[model samples]
Target: MKLLFVADPLASFKIAKDTTFAMMREAQQRGHALAVCTPQGLSWQQGLRVQARVQDIALTGQADDWFSAQPERLAALADFDAVLMRKDPPFDSEYFYATHLLEQAEREGARVFNRPRALRDHPEKLAVMEFPQLIGPTLVTRSSADIRAFHAQHQDIILKPLDGMGGMGIFRVKADGLNLGSIIETLNRDGAQSVMVQKFLPEIAQGDKRVLIIGGQAVPYCLARIPQGNEVRGNLAAGGLGVAQPLSARDQEIANAIGPVLQQRGLLLAGVDVIGGCVTEINVTSPTCFQEITQQTGCNVASLFADALEAAVRGA
Candidate 1:
């Protein structure tokens, strides 16, 4: 199978920690052809969707690990059996446009994971607010008054931008904390966009467990993002340490409940974050943590992903 990871630049990839790289390595070990590109590299040409500067891949954990595919423009996207929309997100307008383009690939009968339509429609926070019992006390609003009211009621609340990822625009508000007004200002842009406010779960001080679900079942390994001192956001990219941890029954239940719907939507891979067993985010765009999980368990989860991908390809 020829797979393309529409993600960040290869030169900038930290192979040791990149989940995309881990999957690419697995694809190669299983004798699948793999390539990569960013959204900008994607274009529609003469009724054919294509990418620029794609190359074949090679995997080596040793010093020689490198990409061997020469820098050639890619074949038509539909030429490949599958495409992984592995781009990280703020789910900005441009990313939406990319998903729109991938929708065309679906029309052309190519398999696109986290199905383009599903990816486009699902906003990380709002998607799971449907399950209030599994989520913390949550509210999404653009009104500064409501935000303040929630903070007042909870005494401490976590404010997250509706469309942000990698922990960007996530702020902690205290009952008497400073800068509440400015935080509200940042969240409200003339009331066009709404921010998500949830009761601050004290278990966040312990960690936010990132559970990876492939084909809608909980994988054995999960990475607990333990927040550093004085930090409220437990994001590994935000200086949180990635420690291996066991999933609580609630975590597994959350995964099981969410998985089938995700699979039916063509989301082959997903990472949902649970802090204090409260579902915080459903990461469908480019859910990561494979490298961290593999390192701690000495398990090649990438192989499991490969197994799933092969099944998808065969079914496709």
Candidate 2:
């Protein structure tokens, strides 16, 4: 199989921890051809099938210099056996436009994992709304008054932008409401944009668990990203300590309820974030922790992902 991974630059990847790299490595080891491109390489001109400037590459099995690549060439997205959308998010306009192009490729018979339309539909921060029973008290609004009211009710609430990633722009307001007004202004851009506010989960002290769902089934282990020092965010990118552990009963319950539904929506892989057994986010774009969990638990996550991807491609 010829696989095209649409993702960030190879130079930017920390191979030891990059989930996309882990997937690529597994596929390559299984004798699949590999190619890659960034979202910026995608283009659709009048009458041409949606295409990308992709580089066909092979993994070198080395630490510093990992891949050897051929020069970039134009290829229709449908030319590959599978197109993996591994691009990370801000989900800005460029990323949004890239999905439309990928969707066009799908019409041209390209098999894209986590279908482009599904990615557009499930904004990581907003996707949890679909499973209210799995989440805690949450609110999304642009009005400061509404946020203040929520804060008043919850006493301790977390405020973050609707499009934030990697724990950026996240704030916590205590019962005293220190800097509540300023946080609301910053997060909502003075009511020009909406924000997501949720009751601060004290279980955050334990860790924020990332439960991976592949092919509508839960991975047996999850990476619990525990906050370090004074940080409130338990994102690995935010310097959290990642501890791989077996999924708790609550984790399994949440995964069982949500995984199949997301898979039906064309999400081949998803990372569901849970704090205190309450769903916090549904990460559809470029979910990580594959290497961490695999190294720690010996679960072979990338291999499992390869199995699912191969099955999906065959079915397609």
Query: Which stretch of 10 consecutive residues in model 2 shows the poorest summed lDDT?
Result: 182-191
Which pairs clash (backbone N, Cα, C closer than 3 Å) in model 1?
Answer: 56-69
Residue-level lDDT tens digits of model 2 in 1-316 = 9999999999999998999999999998999999999999999989899999999999999999899999999999999999999999889999999899999999999999989999999999999989999999999998899999998899999999888899998998999999988888778887899999999999999999999999999999999999999999999999999999999999999999999999899999999999999999999999999999999989999999999999999898
The stretch of ten residues in a row with the least summed lDDT in candidate 1 is 47-56
Winning model by TM-score? 2
| TM-score between candidate 1 and the true structure | 0.95
Best by lDDT: 2
lDDT of 1 by residue, 2-111 (tens): 88888887777788788888899888877887878788877776756544456666665664446665666756667788888988887888999899888887787768
Clashes, model 1? 1
